[model samples]
Target: MVHAFDFTAPDSYILNCSTLLTELPVLERAQAAKDAGFDQVEFWWPFDGNPTPTSAEVDEFITSLENAGVELKGLNFWAGNMAGGDRGMVSVIGAEDDFAANVAIVVEIGRRTGCRAFNALYGLRTEGQDPSGQDSTAAANLDLAARAVAEIDGTVLVEPVSGAEGYPLKRYADAAEVVAKVRSEGPANIAVLADFFHMSVNGDDVAAVIEVEAANFGHIQIADAEGRGAPGTGSLPLRDWIDRAYALGYTGQVALEYKQDRATAFDWLSHVTQTA
Candidate 1:
């Protein structure tokens, strides 16, 4: 199998800016990455902070990409819909009127950028609800998500926040079940985003876990196990993921999405960038 290797970039993979679209202006950020020899990066909520940078901004962002020789890989949709939504992972189907209204804002962002991936939220659970009710409600919320993004032209990702309760998907299989069930319905737009740090926090078995959802797996976010910092900062057996990706015929972005406890995670990225 052919590995992505030099085929992928990581400069934009950082979540360094306190808020989306902040920090260096989009153009400057792209230029910096190009100067540093990176070909790929991502924008969190590119719509926030600034009035949607005009075509002028898109022009600049694109220009930076051309100059820096970088690719705008993907945009993670973080429109506050999931922020206070009970640690995330509910089905937005049952959200209060305000909740649905809130998510619409995120949907608008996806539409504007034509983003392919988005995180679905299901505000806090309904108090004093039963198991069957909860399951049905969750299912409804998943349906609502699929419907909301039906015209989004991209994929809507479902991620189970690490360290959360009941939704304990310490492994990919557990997570896959959630994805699979959601997709079992019509129009398979729902996919799973594997986050290594959270898996580590739950003491999950990555090898067996990832295989379960290998197919449904769309994007990946990883970092050292400690402090949610960049790789090389901790002792998480990360290479195993590379090995698994190759062996499983996986072809997706291994996004180095993590917090910048210091600068970016460019330390050992050179070798890995060429090999990615």
Candidate 2:
């Protein structure tokens, strides 16, 4: 019941600025999150259409973060056509080169900003490709990312996503196994991204997963299960569950990656400020 955590804790709660500021352009999300009273922000690939954006675009992105005065806590490598239903591209057979191309840019963004956490979405199953082959591709790409980010002492996050995207990494163990596989091949920077909303949607024992996977967890994301909305807008006991994660040794940022009307998204900001 006592979910009181230090608000000043390093990487306390990160606002997934991309999810929160849906109405705004990618460049404006950071400012929106800052206006909402969040000091740290994370995002999916800012350029959803381009795996390798131009140098000017990358500089603009860095400047946005700088001007918004928000620390970039997390960033996802280029997940192919995420808005078009592709959960990830790292495992796609033909996407290996593109995924590789995006690595240096992702690392540079992290390097220029102080972001140390990166999320890699395991690509969805292709109709004709064998599952085993796809798994191999994912492992290889994840390994590459792990090695690159390790230069900056960064962590690579693997998360289980939900919905009808037919994504192979839909369970906590599924993601953990991939993280382990990547770590086996490279540095130990690979870890599971424990998004309770996805676990709950997949019917995993959330509490048990937290207890067992806390040590391997690199980052945490949250949303209420009923509609993938803000913490107070759904059925999940987010306050208690998040406290449990912190108690069990999860020191990373608890990213608010959810869907809600931006106009009222900060309604629970006061509660988070008080309780977290």
Candidate 3:
């Protein structure tokens, strides 16, 4: 049952509570993650559709992490109503102000939590709006985000998501392209978020991407392809991909963002952590 990678390292992986622990309330997920043996956790926008949540809400969030003794390693900027079909506000034409507002909040959160990585999901293509315009808006917002986070020594991440129709960034290269564009414009802190499940589902050569773009990765997330479950639940070389990324000099935490029962979602880690 020995695995090639060491899953016992304290900083090696981050449990993505946003996707994994669905049964628990948002505030409780941090403690749940800690109880599950993770010292770090990442989350999507916790505020329900509100770009600017009250200070009390923010305080509660930080307190939860503190109470659980789990570090907030990564977080998403307010991507508009994810459950209602809005993927992100970054590229939405009229949502520029909201995105800018969210950036400030995210920066403050990063300052308080020592979290340096922030994922900015690119919004889906609008029905009649010009794609070029949306791209421009996205670039502008990304630049703004990068600059805002830079004050906290933070990084802005662009990720390719799957199962999200109209989501423009579906492949590693697609997200990388956006990253390249934003980075070129003077925000050096921007990078691509390599989500293996999304890339694999979108038909990207995940291994090749790791080999070539490891240096450009700000963070790495994984879930088995086809089912978006735990490491061993679907067909993906999760261990090899992770080992390869580490060998290629990528040192960021690997986020486990998958949908599965809490009881068995992390069962694979038990085997991986076992010594021969």
| Candidate of highest lDDT | 3
Total backbone collisions, model 3: 0
Clashing pairs in 1: 4-276, 5-275, 5-276, 12-41, 12-42, 34-68, 90-122, 93-141, 172-209
Clash count of each predicted structure: 9, 0, 0
Sorted by TM-score (best first), the order is: 3, 2, 1
Global local distance difference test of model 2: 0.84
- Judging by lDDT, tell me the better candidate of 1 and 3: 3
Every model's TM-score: 0.69, 0.93, 0.94
| Candidate 2, 143-254: lDDT as tens digits | 9999999988898899999995579888899898888887776689888999999999998889888777675678889899889997778888877777777777777768
- Rank by lDDT (best first): 3, 2, 1
**Highest-TM-score candidate:** 3
Q: Tens-digit lDDT track for model 3 on 119-204?
A: 99999999888999999999999999999999999999999999888999999889989989988889899999999999999999
lDDT of 3 at 54: 94
Badly placed stretches (over 4 Å) of model 1 are: 6-40, 43-86, 92-99, 102-108, 121-132, 165-170, 262-264, 271-276
* Candidate 1: tens digits of C-alpha lDDT, residues 1-276: 745454224432433222222346655665555544555666654434332345555555456556765565555443333233343434323343433443465466556544456655333344566656665666656666667777776666665456446454445555567677777876587777777777777777766666765545777777678776666778887777755755676666666656662244465555333212
Candidate lDDT scores, in order, read: 0.56, 0.84, 0.88
Off by over 4 Å in 3: 1-5, 8-11, 271-276
Model 1: number of backbone collisions: 9
Residue 159 lDDT in candidate 2: 90
What TM value does model 3 have? 0.94
**TM-score of candidate 1 to 2 decimals:** 0.69
